[model samples]
Target: MMEKIWQRKTDETIGKPILEVFPELLDQKYPELLNDVLSKGITIRENESIAYIQQKEKLEKFYLDYQYTPLFEKNGTVNGIMITVYDVTNKVEARKKVEVAEQRTRLAIEIAEIATWDLDFLTDNIIYSENLPQIFGQEKGSVITRQKIKRQIHKDDLPVLKKAFGLALQTGIYKYECRIIKPDAEVCWIRVHGKLFFDENKNITKMLGTVLDITDEKNSHQTLMKSEEKFRLLADSMPQHIWTSDPLGNLNYFNKSVYKYTGLFIDDLKEQGWIQIVHPDDQKENINSWMEAVKTGNDFLFEHRFRRYDGEYRWQLSLAIAQKDEYGNIQMWVGTSTDIQDQKNFTDKLEREVSERTAQLELKNRDLINMNIELQSFAYISSHDLQEPLRKIQTFASRLSDLDEQNISAKAKTYLGRIEVSAKRMQTLIQDLLTYSRTNSAERVFVKANLDEIAEEVHSDFYERIEEKKLLSIFTL
Candidate 1:
């Protein structure tokens, strides 16, 4: 090819190598390719050289190997230079795309915290994802084999896992939720979801799966279940009357206290039979409300009186509610009923005591009223009797005081005046005493009043006494 190109007519083709024809090629289009040109340019097309310049000036480039190559020639240069064109863009771009995809896959594996595995069931060969090292607690390229994978699973769960995995392979369905053991002897739960594909022969050709660490979620669920069971047992063992009912108001369960209180066996109060023991006054309303809750799928909470073992009625505060399904349908109702019998007993005792105290108070009040009436009559009679004597003494004394010297001596007149003055003072004192004592044991009546207004009235009544005593009194709230 090189000899043919060199022997061509000068007018038909320029034998100058591509670099000789375009001496500034390295400095022209892609200067970064200078190293590439010096190291690798000649190896691409060493048989060819710049053969012709198409432009009138030396700036034009023409193809010598084919029309794709561009060649140029300088005006004064004796020896021509050759420049070679090599196409490497397509391969480089393809390699870059592959590198990007690999990097993205690696980044995804790191973020998910998940490890993947591939198995060729036909060859019994196993390949692991890049993240396998973190999950296995081993470095990359650790010894991985079929036996190693099987040994990592929990011993007790091996059979169960194998059955599920086999079923998936046979059915082309994904098997999931297998627990495994880590090398650290830690019990780790893993949710393995894998799909198996089969060839035309119905033999599994490939199996791919993802491995996740589910130890925390599983442990949390078990802990919650255990806590719930503990609470249920504790509540069921209590002595307080306990009972649970369905959303339709049907009694489903009851503790020993309920049986003891009602004298009814477990079988006696099934369905709606318990309503027969409710107080007649509240039974209809209670049953209606419970039925409404069931119809509406709302929570039921009510309290009513029920018949006791002694043939007497007892008040019970029963609470129940509907436990609903995801679609808001009432599935069941569960609640506890506490005896409240002690509360009823205490309340009855208090009511009886209050009634007895009220009766005693009425009797005492009647007695106090009667005594006050009698005392008021007695005071009126006594004050009238005393007033008549004082009036007579004052009249006689005043008469004697107005007498002449012959009838009454000056000393006698002075004594009479003194006696008349003293009699009037005594009468005034008796009247005031009667008024004060009259209010002491009168009829007792109670009414609510504004305390501040009452205090103001009392203060006015004592104003004179306070002024007479010259006392300064300070009152505050």
Candidate 2:
């Protein structure tokens, strides 16, 4: 072994002096140690002692377990030094590598705020990492035991912890999350994962586990729960029927108003779906519209009749919109159904009334048209038949007046004049009446009329009456 380690031939080292064979030992502690052993007549030994030697003109390092013993003769004197050596370089280097790796693992555990523990049930003792005390909010160097650790656990979680241990004994696996109270009275959450070890007798002998602090995660979860509760309360307070569904469009939640309006329990709605409350005639269209919105992740809108709690079907305007996450992924759907039954009834009544009124107005319009036709016929008769007789009377009266004065008496002539005046007035009045009727029936054409001409016509028609009454005339121009 020495020859192999020194990398020299046995012939070169076998009978040589120690200093001559290993000249490199002159500057090392081996020479001094050998001399001390010889002088003291004693034996000395070292294990895994480091040495540097020159081999083939190169310096190389080695670890060795070596011994130096003084050789004794019968005179009670040491005559020479005996040396023994064994190489241990490989074992020492491997051990050093293992130590380095263990150090790295410990550092990683510390950085991650994890604590490792080993519980020996046989001894009822615990061996834990250096940071365990700090995790429990105890002072450094505090002795940790199973009982102490259990004491730190929240009282409410003791039963759960016990159950987990019992299960771990049966199943060889242990996992639990529970709250722990620090020495300073601050509460924190912890998650424990462990594996159980048993003896040949099937009795638990040890447990190995890691503990991690989860207080922040617990607080965040609690905040989210509170926010969801608030949302539920707000939804329930609203008058409209509010509901929510998962991303897959499965209805999961309905507010108080929905229960009040439909008179159905949550489980009933969940099992049968809220669509069961829709009027049968509207169910198909409602399902179609809702499914289309879900498949496309679009807003939903539909007007349908819903069966109310009292068994009356009322019109509802239902609307839904998708709620999306920051990544634009649909998270859920929120929906509302508003009662528009009164408005719908009012609109239907108005439309009916409008139809009835329109029909009545059309009938009245037809009656007025017939009446206008009768007036036109009357005007035609007045213009023709009435004027022809008046013309005859005036012509006969003129003929009479033209006859000799001796043939006609004064009283008869006066009656003839009055008859002629009356006939002329009747003719003029008939003409005016016909003109007024024509103006009403025909599209009016505006034309300039001489006021003086109209006045002269009127004067000629009433000349005999005006002469008989001797009425005064006034005109402003």
Candidate 3:
């Protein structure tokens, strides 16, 4: 009410003509008051306001509901005018704030990609926001209907939306996700959430809902699932017994080879159950080493026997490596057991055969050495024994020849000469035998010997026979 009163400081000349009193109010803002009333001498009424500056150097704005009433004399003609103003600034400011908040709400909805809709179930009509058509790939603010919205939904998802809405009357709320084909034929996923508004009679009156574009979130989840499936398929297809466990070494998965080799099912292999297939002698060592590797995030290697499906233990080379994320945190442990039984058996057999053959060859070598020594001894004795008999024959032949040649006949002389020659030949054979023995038993030293010296020695030894037989002369060249 205090703001409704026009101040005297601003209206000091209020009793004067309108234009002369408030020169700031041009004909544009107070048009009828200045022209129609003052010139035509008639009543004018309107709802308009003006701003005026007062004594406080502060701007004061006003909204007034004013009327101009004409005053006349006893005659029928008008003579004067009366004007009134009432302030309505508070109403104007309150309405302006409401408009500003509405504009903000609209902008926020667009930024969040939320499409709002109101469905009047009684009329079977749906009213959508201005941007709803654009969300469905149509021009903005285009006319749309319930049937048209249903047609935009993917055929496969139509029944799902129908079912959800059918129950909404009883539930008072409905929420669902489905795919829709836009007007341009591009597919997208959307999430709808709404609640039913009920009348006082507890009957459904309308429904309000918001739609959100969830295409990116849906695609990302699908891609992750596909990657996991592919990894499982590859692991199961391997020939070696492949397995994986959590970072703490708690086993979680095993490939098909593991089940086939161990005669165990997946349910039986949870946690530490895989240890049952390890040979009793190796179980403790295997478990301890595996735990150590997991604790340190290091590669693990061990060789141990494992029981197979047919109840036989075979040597297996077990290897494990830590699989880590980009941050270097261990995500899991991957391990494999490769069959090495055949190679192990072959190497052991080869070693045993090599050892046996070495022993046999050593014994044969000793026997050959002893036999060589005995043969050398016999050669030396034979050469010495033969020389003595030949020398005795030569001695007897020489003595008989020395007997008087006049008493001996010619035939006796020829027989005695033949005996002497045979004795000389025997002595030469013995000398050669001794030389052969020396070469075998003694270490021979090579020395340069003169050929002329050796020939002279042979000639001196046979000089008597050469002279008697009148043989060719021996030259010592």
Candidate 4:
């Protein structure tokens, strides 16, 4: 073994001096150690001692376990040194690599603010990482034990941790999130994860675990909870029945108005659905519309009847819109149901009244048409039948006027002349009446009129009456 380590033949080293066989030892502690063993007649041993040896004409490093003992002469004087050596390079190098890896792991844990611990049941002691003390707000290098860790836990959380430990004994797994109080009395959240080890007798022998500070995460969660609570309170105060659903169309939240209107609790709605409150006839359409809106992520609008708590079904106009995220993905559905029973009743009443009024107007319009036709016939008859007799009177008076003056008396002539003038005026009045009636039946065309002619005609028609009343002077102009 020595020859192989020295890269030389056994015969070359067996009787040779130690320095001659291994010239590199002259610069190392091996020579001095050998000298001391010989002079003092003592022995020296070393394990895993580093040495540089010449191999293949090049210096190489090695780890060795070696011993040096003095060989004594019968007179009790040290004569020589006996040496023993064994190579331990592989074992030592493996240990060094393991130590380096362990150091790196410790550094990573510290940077991530994690504490690792190991508990030995037999020793009733805990071995923890360097950062464990700091996690509990203690000075560096402070000794940590299971009892010390337990004391740091919040009083309310101690029982929880105990329960977790008890379960771990049976399950071989430990997991819990709990609150802890630091030495400064600051409360914080932590998550612990561990695994249990058991001996052959099924007794827990050791436990290894890691702890993480989760205070920031817990604080953020709490803030979100408070905000949601505020939203719920505001929703409850509204008069409209409001509700919300998950992205999958699962109804999850309902406002106070919904419960008051439907007279159903949340648990009751959960077992079935809000559709229970829909009027029986509207249920099918309501379900279809809602499902379509959810599938397409579109707004929903439907007018349906909702059964009230008092057993009366009232009309409701329901509208729902999808709440979307930045990516345009549906996050939730917000919906409202507004009571429109009164408005619906008003609309129906107004339609009925309008229909009745329309029927009455049609009847009145027919009567007006019949009355206009009768008036037109009366005007035609008055123009033809009445004017014919007046024409005969004027012709007869003309014939009489043509007779010799001696044949008719002056009184008879005057009367004949008055009769003829009256007949002519009556005929003119009848003709004017016919013209006015004809114009009324169509679009009337207005024209400039001679006021003098109209006045003369009026004077002729009333002249006799005016003369008899002795008021003829009124028409002198």
Candidate 3: list runs displaced more than 4 Å: 1-150, 162-175, 191-214, 217-237, 361-477
User: Between candidates 2 and 3, which one is better according to TM-score?
Assistant: 2
Off by over 4 Å in 2: 1-116, 122-152, 155-160, 166-172, 182-186, 237-239, 260-263, 308-312, 397-432, 439-442, 445-477
State the lDDT of candidate 1 residue by residue for 272-297, as single tens digits: 48777788999889989888877886
- Can you write out model 4's per-residue Cα lDDT over 260-280, one digit (the tens) per residue? 998888899999888888889
Ranking, TM-score, top scorer first: 4, 2, 3, 1
C-alpha RMSD for every candidate: 16.7, 11.5, 14.2, 11.6
The 10-residue segment of model 1 with minimum total lDDT is 62-71
**Structural RMSD, model 1:** 16.7
Clashes of each: 19, 0, 0, 0
Global lDDT of each candidate: 0.70, 0.89, 0.80, 0.88
CA displacement after TM-score superposition, residue 181 of candidate 1 (Å): 3.5
Please give each candidate's TM-score.
0.47, 0.62, 0.49, 0.63
What tens digits encode model 2's per-residue C-alpha lDDT throughout 22-110?
A: 88888899878877987899899989999988788888899999988899999989998877898899999999999999999888888
**Reference-based lDDT, residue 473, model 3:** 67
Best by TM-score: 4
- Residue-level lDDT of model 3, residues 234-294, one tens digit each, is 8888888888889999988888988998888877776459888999999999999998999
